[model samples]
Target chain A: MTDLTAAGRGVRRRGPRTRWGRLRERGYPYALLSPPALLVLGLIAYPVVLVVEMSLRDGRAMNISAIGQEPWSISNYVDVLTDGDTYHSLWITALYTVISTFLSLLIGLGTALLLSRDMPARRLLRTLILVPWAVPGVVASVVFLFMLDGSYGVVNWILRSVGLTEHGPQWYFDPSTALAAVIAPTVWKGFPFFTLILLAALQAIPDELYEAARVDGASAAARFRYITWPAIRGTTVLGIILTGLWTFHTFDLIYPLTGGGPDGATETWAIRIYTEAFSFFHPGSASALGILSVVLALVVVASVFPIMRKQFF
Target chain B: MNLDRRQFLHRAGLGTLAVAGAGALGACGGGDTSSDGTMTLDFPTWQGDEAGVKTWWRQAIASFQQTHPKVTIKLQQVPFATYTDTLTSRFSAGKAPDIVHLPTTTFGSFAAQGWLANLDDRLKGTDILGNWTKVQKTMMWDGHNVGLLVLGYAPVLYYNEKLLKDAGVAVPTTFPELIAAAAKLTSGGVYGYGATTTSHPGTYSEATWMVYGAGGGWSAGEKLRFTDPAVVKAMDDYRTLARYSPKGVPSEQKRTLFFDGKIAMMIEGPFVYAGLDKAAASVKSHVKLAKAPFVQQPGYPSNSIHVSTQASKKKADMAWEFIKSLTTPQTQASYAQLYGVPSPRRGAVTQAMIDKRPELGLFQSVTDSAVDATPDNKDIVTNFSEVQKLIMDACVRLQTSSTPTATVMADLQNKVNGAIK
Candidate 1:
């Protein structure tokens, strides 16, 4: 009989085949993705687990031997919660994140709207707007430090020339201004990210909406409020959440500029974590503080996520 | 259908596990020791970043290698700002180098942590102990020798003589006079007095000199003495002088300002001499050195060398040998002559060396009364940097706001007490 005999019928219907073939057929996509998943577990998840485990132990500079050797307890978390400075730092971090994120989004949205229009040197301007974001955080901090220096900064020179005051304010040294000084650079560096994202979102908005709003006798503000705002709400919320998380953990920007100084006025939770671990050599406490910081950041992101989901998905 | 999906998921999960298992196995490779019966002793120091200082170190290392032919001394250069962080990370990873260039402020903490090898038994009846000053002896932790003094220098007041002369002001010999001179000298863009008032560790060191000069310190016999009347007075005096200085200037900026004639006076160590020598002719011509005006003899902040616990026993001995070699009179003298810094070894500053740089003589003269600024309480003292930050924060408040002195001092006292407790 031929291979296509009635009983055989096209190689006997191929039924499950070999076990290895079945496995490949079922798991090919997951096999292709396993390397990255493994990397994420190794690098990110492993360290996170270590940090959380460390946060549960009693550790300090004097008792390095006791680290992870002692019984695990919530004593570190208890101490962190009871400490007044911890709350102060947490408050500072929250204020910093909120103000910086708000200012960044506002400035980014304004710039995005401006640049989205038909303007002179539009492409060149769009490219140049990214310079701040492209600049390293430390470099941006140093640049702002020189500009706002009390003695011979260009900012001071400009203020003096304009007769703003007799002596320029100590932007970095005064408690009242230190946070603002650090925030200025942080916002400057951060807004560009917002601008790029929001600009894309604004461009995605169809031109017909604006034309329709204009035909209905809407003013610029009215059009922005009705058409543009609705179109970009989801992107704006996402941008703020992303930027807020980053600004909440902004150590490099603040450390180089004010070092969270002028009596710890700028000492946010992130700075506290650094000082605890590096300066005090107490990784346990630092880890505890770090965990708290992450939880707070996650809470902020979670609260914003649902709104984003509802607006978009 | 559900059974097939479950099997597929189980296999995919196994795929992830297999990848992770392979990675863990790959990273589990062992650390191998050197073959051919040669031992490598790694020595990490911040001085290697300095061109001149690095030259001196390379010479020292070469000489050390010549004597210890079987041991190779590897020099690891780290930046000063991140040196502590780097050292701690190395220690945590169990890969610390054999020799560590320890800062005085951190020696006690490292020793307490048992990261450093005790040199007391190792160096018994040795001349290294006799060579160090009383201040250097404080490097011992719990009566065990933890660090050997490597380089020592007392901070002194560096001034622009031209600016003082033009202002018709004499060199201030007392704290009040210094403040008055600063006020007089602070006309135009030039500040009368300059010290780093930022949160840099050097800021704490410089400010503490003023406190020690005022007969105040962080502790007296294990008691928290930060709120002493003397400390308060010193803080007020600093605040006054700070008014005449540009606010929020860093250490390097202060040095540059002094060199450029924008700062009439500043507090700095012997390192300032080198910086002055590098300045333009006008700035260099205007430079002057004076003993730091203090009621008590101010402590000389010094750096020490320690053998790491992570080193093997033989390598530790070699590391100790290398540290001892650094403290020799000959090496100390050579270092002083080349780098213009004072040596911790007594009598290491030769007459010829002093004649070469007069500032060396001034720094040497002040060494006799140099005290350790570290608090006597070992428990709280390990957190010296935190204390320094607290004091610095209070100083900032005193300068930036019209806070009552008593209120500020009380707050500082509370903060310090809380930290130590």
Candidate 2:
């Protein structure tokens, strides 16, 4: 009991750590993460700041070098907000995104369910489902353009063989069908993403859960409702959010297919931004529209956050 | 030989940083200037890969290099669809090519941005001022000659002799007769007219020809005339003509249809003659060019060559020499012969050229009296791209909708007015 009370038997008391050592221990993880954080700031934040700055300048003729010297104003925002085309584009974007997302999710879920069962060439079929996604957007647009061509498309040929009608409708040029025609390729390209995600989530479900449901005398629909739906609800919501965002910002498909033609029937926000920037050479207006699009996307996310938090968080 | 994990990471990091630094330095470098005093002038053109045009360029470049041994012209090919946008991006980035070749429609925009060097001083002792075509006058921007006009021609009416003969139609010389002939030729997967009904940049030019033919125009100085009675009539006529043409086809596709023997008639520039060499065998011999069936001939400066402001003074002088070489009488004659289009210089089309391609006579006569179809008003010309969009949108509406021509034109007038302001 000689020094047990004071120094704990043969152990000496250590002095307090130095200030530099304490700070280093606290900041070591952040230092390791600083490179990626700086990259994100440079890549993402800088462009956003530049766009916001350009939106406040007069950008007629769109000389990028002269943008900094131009006088700053809110006229770009005023012009974008006051124009009727902006609202029309917003409406078109909403319709295209919602319909395309819903259809993609439905098709993806169906395909995933079909593939989850044992069948011949199941692996091959699953791999083949990704072909549409692998094909470049412009290439896919070109293919669909040929298939849905008014005068000589294979779809029209099939329709004629079945006696649907003579000289099938102008799918891309007709205002009534142009939006739907654009959405077809979009769904074909987008559904594979959901299929990949949902298939993983589907495979993770235990066989015991389905077997117990079967023994409990549940119907197939009931078993799906209790086990499959609950298991994949969170992933489905995530897929919807992601697909919605992508569809809202899609430009390559619609631009090459119609260039926002047929009297602006398929002109969405992204197309409008392009026409304003590259076509009209009005970078100020384009930047303003881009900022508004970001705001619109955030609003949509905010609206869906409550439901997502209830299920996912 | 025994590298620890930390040492390996240290070496890898240094290597990555070195590579990235080298890439950044490489990106900052512009046109090449070698130690032997040899300089490379970057020249980009949409016509660099065209069948006959590329031949002309090769010969021209070879001749220029023979004279200036230490100077090399680096010719780059850019597709016409994205040419202007590419140039604009380059100019904005302060990396403009030493030699700037642009569609005449976009010349004003580049000039307005000060990307093109003023060429009046360089032209003081040159024959370009007096001997070039009248359309070359369009090269003046804000009292400065910033470029040289390369090609100018009246739009030509191209028709398939086989289709017209099979339909028992004559080569029409008037708008009404043309429509009747088109109606006769249109049947069973074949079209009578081959207008660009899609939302294309060419749609404005196609519709503008109709407007000018109908004695209307987009603007007169600062005055907007989209709602003029003649314009309305022209737009209505265009809609009626669209019925006989294939729907939703762009200029290239329409040209393809004509080459495939599926289209009977189309109106295009004399450049279409070059494409006939690649047409289907059955259609190639049957295609012929005539004066466009319009009351007035519509023409504009097609393309031009200029020295960029971004080039050094020495390089710019070299660029000017290359451009001047292209405009020489001998080179001009060769260009007209090889390219099958009317050259900008006077007396460039020799009798031999006309004898080789009989269409040259008609091309010259029409080009001699062709009225400029582009907007002449300062504000309108400054905002031509926006005005072009409005016109294209109106054309698409007229083609795809049943709305009255008056209503569509009125909407366009309002939109164009707002755009110019």
Candidate 3:
């Protein structure tokens, strides 16, 4: 009877303590992660929430305080969604992103292939190629502006000297060529990043694979198709995704060059948002457009992922 | 000295919280006053680095400091291109400067937001009400005096006498004549005319002068007249003139071209005279000023000063005092002399000032007859930035495309109407 009473006491003592121990064990990882989780919540999640809230308000409020007093409505979203200019900007953004990304990748891939081969001053050339990427966007835009000046630009001088045409095209002033002109500088700045990434990926390919392919009567083209492409295909896809995203939001080069002018030919979604918010003092509309942009970007990514799934997975 | 994994994480989490809390506190903590009982008043202006205006402001600040030794005036230099946007951002963040200096074109938008303090009572005790020029009326918004107009001037035509003589083009006194002269002067790497042909903020002013010169304006009271025949004709004429200008050049670069004798003629404000000292000697010797070759003269308030509503009572009072010092007759006279332009104060340009600058008389006469370049409509004024954008867009369309001016203007009218509504 005394033995049974001692065993009952032991069970009673262990019950609450065992439950506490289980709780602590389950919560340990979360407790360790709370600091960084909270930081992300504060930094990234909070501003996004604020922007979403701001998008729902109605008014041309320039400040947060004034915006808070504005009436709650979805009119900003309705306005942004219904505006024809929004679609036009989206179209421009697509063209800019797609063309810029494709050109950057092509040039990057070519340069990476060249630099991969044993060549004279290969390291020096590789380092020097990053000069464009190193140049600040604003600085690059300014330099290109001077170089592309229609009347006094060195470009005009060269074109005239080479007997290309009687008069040099007004590269930035004319709408027909402004997009291409702005794209040139962007590609120049963007291609270097692709080169760096793809170059690293290329160096990882085994030389024995190429040597063995050559011995097996595989042509250079066939070798590249079977071995080189498969090896770097994953990195190229990533590079395209990243470069496309960057190009989609390009504002610095375009803003200083043309300001989406000569009839909004170069007006992308990002520039439109900026013009609406700062130039027109319509923050609500700007925020709405921003939200729509995120949605559009997600849609693009989702759609593209399925097509590229086999490579990534 | 040694903690278990959970304890270390708990302490790390606490440390992060404390660090974030400290950062938040630091960001929120801002005081103009120091422990020594000294105060600093934030003053931001695009003119902080402008040649003659910078010198005038330095002298004015020094004089004001002599009387108020405990108060420091912090002059923040923001580039003109980004000045308004920067100010808007600062005001939105509730960190508005104590003394607000705004371009007159952007003043109405700031005042409409109630970001500027009402100065009706402050103006009553001063001579500024009766003694200031007619353009001072621009400072009044919704029947309240909210700012003090400091600079007002008419646009003047600056010509190169040597270029005109070389090209055998007489000084133009009419729009058609001006175009003819500009065309004749174009050759040998020299542009016949200088204009802000690029997509820039100055495009607004450049387009305004052309439309106003032809006796058409963006609006009349609440009615927009963008589709008027006169405006279309003026824009068409402007397009023709642009062909003779350095393509895609901004106003500052256009001025540089003029100073370098690469541009034969340009229309600008009397303030452009302040830059004469920097002009090449060959160009300076041949530079001349005349009334703009247009039927009507374009003029507007250039810039103004105000006390921000965000300022504390003490800071507001100090700002008002500093502004008052700038308006005093002696200071106004000095400003007129230094700036090479007429001050807003009445009788600020004395005979001595005119004698010092023979061109001052023409500037004064032109100022007397000058029409306000900005529209008088309250709605348009309140939504000036939007209207300005629409107009600038229209101007670009006219300049770069073969689009019919009437079609462009009609489209602009619809956009402006929609914007204001």
Candidate 4:
């Protein structure tokens, strides 16, 4: 029987006759991996630590010299949590992130499934679908803006002509529609990436498994449930994580569209941090806010990763 | 703004990414200084038409450099939207140019921050400084007497000539006449009047006119008493103006309706006249510029107080000489003829100039009355946006919802006050 300690220590030993001996001979691989491991640690970890350190300090505009001197305080977090003006923005951002991520994944996976089936002219359709990703977010948002314009937008014009809407759909001016409109471009621009990834994952599954399932009298739905889903589940979860992070950090789409205005309906923390730091010149506060947002994002990622691993992998 | 360990570094989020990503759409290729002692003159415009502004600056520079053989000029045009990020990054990285055009609103703050070369000491005896009008006071910061205000626009009410004629409403003067005109023009879905919201740079020019005319001007020391009886009354008076406007008329909306002749009137500065010449020349004949309509107040000016928006025009080596040339009596007349826009100077105005440009009187009178927006230390550009937002919000609430005047005014005051601090 093999002892557990060596495995825990990740130790490999070379001996003549067994599998352990061969694996032990290849132990130098980890040494080669050390550089990247350290690079990620230095790049991702050091900044994270610095930011956390910053979040603990009080910040001010004009007195940039005070950044290092101010003692650690819970005041920033307290103020954010207690401030009535920002609370609604925070709530809206959270709801927006989750809903947009979920919808993006669902639509992405659906498109992936459909495209994977080898329909006629699938390549052309895929090209058309993926084109939105090529345009910069600001440009994409701007184009959509013109398309949804109240008076002369093609979509609104069609709707008005068809008697579906008399005036126009208040996509940006109205509060309820504003949040959704901002989220629309994110899902549109991002869905193609997720679709391609999921499709690749789907394609990687062996054709033999489907044939075997059919031979066993399994229904198409059952075969999909048994084989296709388990195969692509890992990729889907990774896609969701990436999509969620992107949604959480998205600024340009929301900023130009609503400007966190029309009654502050779209004022996400990102918009708040930007306006504070640049517009107001409150660098310390902006950095501190940035750190807080990053920390929250880390916690969100950390929490989600484990859940995804257990449920999907 | 402190983020805890987990949230501080998730730049994968677009918001965090935006910290470094705000202005990457810059046009490459910085202009090179040439042998005519060609110095790179950085020109910033609030909008595009790189070629047009560059041509204007190049011509101006070429003319100025002719007198100074050693001074050659090159123009580097930077779009206004990306100017702050581009110049700021380049400057902090030790790549600042010899001369650059700056808006008057930014002169105080930029000078206070030590970004500009002090011209105050140099301008004292120079013909350039001697020729500068009182309107140039708008560009002077407290400590740094650096820079000069060149291009200027005096704010006023702009009406669509066709719209007013169609509605049979004569141009207004008193508060009652204006309201009646707006009401008559506001029959159905059509709005009668519009002003750019605070989010826009144009809002700063408009709001100062409104508030200064209403018996007050903004300063941190004097906490905005927008809710004070006179201020509140001013706001309520504006609410009446709002009935003739769309629920929220952004700058784009204001520009479109006025150009399309959909809206009857807008609060605008002299820039509209420039736009009329170039972009809207066909419709230009249908637009009329007028003094701000009068407001009723016990102790305030009856006419809406207007102010000039100024910028420094660049000329190499003889920076002072270029400024002097621009402010010269003859040059001012030439400029008036070229653009048919207002001149903001104290010197003699020729009959020939007035014959070419109709509003020379208004421009001349307002030059004496132009409010100096130069702040004590920092750029009003920084604070003006916030002021615009707060006042815009108040106006929106006043117009759309039945939000109480006291509540909105107090809210705006608090936000603006907090920002300046």
The prediction achieving the highest DockQ against the true structure is 3
TM-score of each: 0.91, 0.94, 0.94, 0.78
Backbone clashes in model 2, listed as residue pairs: none
Model 3 C-alpha lDDT per residue in residues B292-359, reported as the tens digit of each score: 99898887788999999999998899999999999999999888888888878889889988997888
Model 3 bad stretches (over 4 Å): A1-17, A311-313, B1-32
Error of 1 at A96 (Å): 1.3
lDDT by candidate, in order shown = 0.81, 0.87, 0.87, 0.63
Worst 10 residues of 2 chain A by lDDT: A7-16
Model 1: residue A181 alpha-carbon error in angstroms: 1.1
Better of 1 and 3 by lDDT: 3
DockQ of 4: 0.16
* Error at B144, model 1, angstroms: 0.5
Model 1 residue A122 lDDT? 99
lDDT of 4 by residue, B82-139 (tens): 6555644444334555555555544433444455665666567666645555555555
User: How big an interface RMSD has model 3?
Assistant: 1.5
Model 1 lDDT tens row, B169-209? 99988888898899999988888988786767767777778
Off by over 4 Å in 1: A1-12, A17-36, A61-66, A307-313, B1-33
Candidate 3 is graded, for docking, as: medium
